[model samples]
Target: MSSYAAVLRTPHACRAFAVGLLGRLSYGVVPLALVLAVKEGSGSYAVAGSVMALFGVSGVLLSPVRAGLVDRYGPRRALVPMAGGYAALLVVIAGVCLRGGASGVELCVLAGAAGTCTPPLGPTMRALWSELLPDRRMLETAYSLDGVCEELLFVGGPLLVGALVQYAHPATAIALGAALVLAGTVGMTGSPAVRGMGGGEQAERDGARGAWGAPWRPALVAAGVGVGLGGVDLLVIAFADGQGRPSVVPWLLAALSVGSTVGGLVNGAVRWGGSARGRLAPLAAGLAGALALAGFVPDPYLMAVALALAGLFVAPALTTAYLYADELATPGTRTRAGAWVNTAVNAGSSGSSAAVGLVLGQLPLALCFVLAGVPALGSALAVRASRGARAGVPRPESVTRVDPREPRSTAGR
Candidate 1:
């Protein structure tokens, strides 16, 4: 905890971390909020799903480009316009939805635009850590803390959305989410800490490589990890539904998040013996064990405990994945690496969510845990097959010396 404290004791890192969190919460909440609004208005999950799907697809299409822009330009130049513009669009869409007579086609178009304009904040913030802290050990802790904050968002975002939807309105929730994201974006972009992080000559040269470089293979492996983690979330949801204890779901999920947060901090503090690449498989496999045990838990309480244990390895594994990515990525393309991580992980989550949704009605609910574990283990194999087993870079004193004033490089093509 002292190590974690030392990493965040500075004011700039605090601002970035704090505002980054607000933006992340908004991002996590919006999909479900949109679905709830659409479903309540349209009276059909299929149409609601379609609208959200369109939104997601549009975001996916633009993520790489936006990430590239941040790498080329600075975060302020790339993110401010995008975040502000996106918030305004969300406001317009919220008003339209609140007014109650918008056509599905119009809503879909708005959703698509919303997705396309969604600022690539996830990548930008993740990249900021590299430039801000620079020290390898401190960098590990920063990533760990960031990952834990994301877990917190997953836990809290839905609850906030649920409350908003239940009490005021989905439009209120949407507006609030937009406001939070925009505020966070503004705060982060305005911070000089994040703005001057573009690098010098070596970074530019490294960032000049094509997008299809070696970093992507490991990014895909990270995606598989996302699928597994996402599957766990979906399976837990299914398990709650199966047991007719829907409210218990939050407690179970909270336990999972808490465990991950604790484990991630511990992982960060320790000076682990091996390279991140070497540790990746074992950590993932350990998650697989806990997830597999979740398959047979008889009741929700036991399952909650199972989930907590399962979560223990998640952050460490993901931190290692990110560390591996940082090592493999070109100098100027850290933001793009972050973008790849975001895209890959979300892709996995989306896939697993859809898969678990389809199978919940057909198979025994317990088996969903097993099904989810398969991907966690598979991610390990993916890592190996992708030659992600290459050793991690040695920690160097030079890592502490990155200058934030250099112009960052780009590799869009």
Candidate 2:
């Protein structure tokens, strides 16, 4: 009996890990694939960048709807169909660009469609982890591990795409990307741990029927932070392009990722006794400091170091936003709540990218960096204000236990 149980557990862990890896890879590869297709088909960087912006727009528009679907059905049911649809869309787009030569408008439409079909993989996966490991400690560890997985994907996916495009055919890279998405989606859906479990349908129905309330203040603040970071990213890219060293853009971004990964790991390993509200101050302060440094730095290497320091606050702020969403969300709307947070981030990034692209040629890149930091400072101020207002309010104890197969309890208010 012990041996059988061990075997069963091993497969479950492996499947979960594989799903995590695939989810990150799919996300990281899509942008690279789009860049390649646009350069090859249209020979225009601006058009390619526009197509990428369209993808972000579609993600922002579709995330809430997709999240609601996950809440309505289960993540497993929603993910399988969406993933399959996304794979089909990718193949179509690849074929069109390769054979028929997709125009800018056509590419934008297809990219938007592809983005709309993307599954709410991150939130769904988080929900799965919550269900599988009910303990708070384990859940934090799982999220930390997911953060590491994200870094790995960003590191490896572009490298893989670059190699395939350089050595093999670009088509080969697209096909491989589609295959991985399909395989991972199927693997995830078929897993007993994900498929056999679900948050009760009745709770979701009830939650959906309720009136939509005003946006949570903390969530808005977090979205503002995302906007700042997005602007910073655009500035970095612009600076690199202006310097005739576009390749360094990835390294700068990677520095941020590396810093955030370390922060997540450290936060997960340690214990914090204060209320969620209490941590807001330090998180905001850290973000402000990072932003200040990034704005002030002169040299490229120094700028990378400043951006990395800023990144230390990024994951912590994101995790806190998730926690706040969990607190504010209605009983069955957790997935949508999380998705709203994601949508905000994407929307902010999309908006900033568009704004930056127009003035990038006119303005000094250093000024762009300074302007980007303004939003972060603004977000920190907003967070501080919100925390002050809610200082006396009692917070519900954090609930990590999630038995998706079982009905939700109505006892908590």
TM-score of every candidate relative to the true structure: 0.89, 0.83
Count of clashing residue pairs in every prediction: 2, 1
Please write out the lDDT profile of model 1 over residues 1-413, one tens digit for every residue: 88789778744778778887888788878888888777766667777878899999889756877787777777877788888878888888788778876678778888899999888877787778877665677878888888888877877888889877768778777888799889999888877677566445544565675553336545666676677777776687777887888898779988888888888989988877656677887788788888889989889989988988977888888887787777766657777777776787778878888788788768876677777777768878777666434343455633434444554333221
Q: Report clash pairs, candidate 2.
A: 198-404
What lDDT is reached at residue 35 by model 2? 78
Name model 1 segments beyond 4 Å from true.
Answer: 40-44, 199-207, 212-214, 237-247, 361-367, 385-394, 397-413
Candidate 1 contains a number of clashing pairs equal to 2
**Candidate 2 TM-score over all chains jointly:** 0.83
